[model samples]
Target: VLRGQRPDARVIEAVRGVTFDVAVGESVGVIGPNGSGKTSLLQATTGLLPLAGGQVLVRSIPAFLGVQA
Candidate 1:
């Protein structure tokens, strides 16, 4: 999720600016090749990363596949 790093890096624009939403009873899947910004997107949505140009919001618990939840 930490893209390019800099001593004073304050802006963090996620690759491609991918964003989406799901309803109370809706389901969605995120499919992409390796290193396709999937993890980054999850992290950003989970408030683990900061948005550079936009915003991300999550209203439920997130269960990460590999990393600690």
Candidate 2:
């Protein structure tokens, strides 16, 4: 969903119409060029970003930034 050069939600869609599934004990990487919403997607998926578009389900408790569980 590479809409534009910059990560702009208003001007263009960063991660548009994207979805996927992962099994237990699996690892995935969100790789892309700069301003490609890599971090945005990760944060959104981890319940760090505000509820602007979709939903995020956390099966287990997450370890947030600067905090320990």
Candidate 3:
């Protein structure tokens, strides 16, 4: 089961099996077409979204600073 939901239930996989690494001070960008999971990947990486499988490791906790405000 995922997030208290049934395993057999239909669900949308916004992101799946994504893997990568970024060294300190390295620059990176997440680019994709609409509904291609760019935001989902970022959310999963920063713990905003629960991961269904695989793992996410970071040197430190991520902070989400929105443009607004």
Provide the clashing-pair count of each candidate structure: 0, 0, 0
Best by TM-score: 3
Tens digits of per-residue lDDT for model 1 on 1-69?
A: 444457676544446657576888998787889867777777766656554545554554443333332
Better of 1 and 3 by TM-score: 3
Query: How high is the CA lDDT of each candidate model?
Result: 0.60, 0.57, 0.64
Record all residue pairs in model 1 with backbone atoms less than 3 Å apart, i.e. clashing.
none
| lDDT at residue 14 of model 1 (Cα atoms) | 45
Deviation from truth (RMSD, Å), model 1 = 5.6
Q: Write the per-residue lDDT of candidate 2 for residues 22-63, one digit (tens) a residue.
A: 688999987889988887677656545543555555454433
Candidates by lDDT, descending order: 3, 1, 2
C-alpha-based local distance difference test score of model 2: 0.57
Model 3: weakest 10-residue lDDT segment is 60-69
Candidate 3, residue 46: Cα displacement in angstroms equals 0.3
The TM-score, computed over Cα atoms with residue i paired to residue i, of candidate 2 is 0.59
Once fitted onto the true fold, the runs of candidate 2 whose alpha carbons sit more than 4 angstroms away are: 1-12, 58-69
Off by over 4 Å in 1: 1-14, 57-69
